[model samples]
Target: MISYCVFDAYGTLFDVHSAASKFQRILGNKQESVSALWRQKQLEYTWLRSLMGRYVSFDQVTADALQYSLQVHGFQEDSSKVNLLEAYKKLDCYEDVQSCLNQLRANNVATAILSNGTLPSLKTLVENANVAHLFDQLISVSEVEVYKPHPSAYDLVTRKAQIPKEKVAFISSNCWDAIGAANFGFQVFWLNRNENVPDVLPGKFTTIYNLNQLLDKVVQPS
Candidate 1:
């Protein structure tokens, strides 16, 4: 069994869909496609801008994405939408997360979140989730001036936890995360709660639907 578990914050742990959910209340059904597109573009900008050596914070990227998604989706100009989406950092965790994290604590496995978000955003999530104490640490990818899939951000886990990559179980709701961590030689886990397409890439990994499944798979012996 792995001794440490690393998680992605926004989409993986905290309900990243909250941004969309909040928008639905403001713009109704029309907001769905916009929010989704914003999220996609946000990720794209973060990756592309990174490659161009034009470093920007995730919050900036998010605003850039919102602008692009709005223009593409033909939405009216509203700067508030970006701020509204930013409000997602205040979102809570999935219903199952608290109990599931507690289970890992009982097993003495180290748990933490590795995100492209800023330190302030991660702090808000940990506090809103009321599980800050449950984690061994909270790391922002900005520490390396690059995001996940870069390996350096993931390597940050080692600085504090002081463990081998194989001993670390990487859990991500994002397929890209699975592919990246897998390629980096860590034991990856796909927390496929969204039921999206799986990563075709290969690596040392396990795929599970829910956190409770770990009871039989990791916590308890066969």
Candidate 2:
């Protein structure tokens, strides 16, 4: 049985694109492009840093990625960069997050956030969204000094919950993250919110379009 229902914080629980959307007045028509590039670069930087053994906090990576996105889009104003970074500290949670987490709790399942985000930011995010109490833990990759898709990062859940990987249900909107967790032996669920094609990776996992669908898969029929 799955004892813990662990989620990836950014795209899984919190809306990563919401930060740029908040600055639509300034970003104009490029808001979506900026948001997309920012997310893509953020993940790339983490993977690149991990492979190079040059670990930096997610905050730095976030800022660096945003800076690149802004520059490429001709948004050179310092205030634009500053405002977006601050906004990131309190990203809007997904609509399904609260109900899904509540249902998991009602089922007597433990919930946590396993994120590439730093602990402080993760805490700020959940607290801002008014869902902080719903989670039992807010785990950061900083603890292991590595980012997700890495074995050591996925191992954080098992270590913190004191349960074997087989007893943990790992959920993520990112295909790569679900693959990583599945490869590490957890029951992985890919929250494919966008209906995107799965990545051509080695690890195996079940795909679900939304958080509510997760209930059917993990919650055994009583």
Return the top candidate by TM-score. 2
CA lDDT, candidate 2, residue 8? 96
TM-score of 2: 0.98
Model 2's lDDT to the true fold?
0.93
Model 2, position 11, has a per-residue lDDT of 94
Model 1 over residues 1-222: C-alpha lDDT tens digits?
A: 688878888777787667666666555676777767878888888788778878788877877787777778666658656556667677758787888889887888888888899988788878877988888788888888887677787888887688888788888888888888888877878888877778676665677888776555556552
Best by lDDT: 2
lDDT of 2 by residue, 4-113 (tens): 99999999999999999999999999999999999999999999999999999999999999999999999885999999999999899999999999999999999999
- Candidates' C-alpha lDDT: 0.78, 0.93
Off by over 4 Å in 2: none
lDDT (Cα, 0-100) at 36 in candidate 2: 99
Which pairs of residues have clashing backbones in candidate 2?
Answer: none
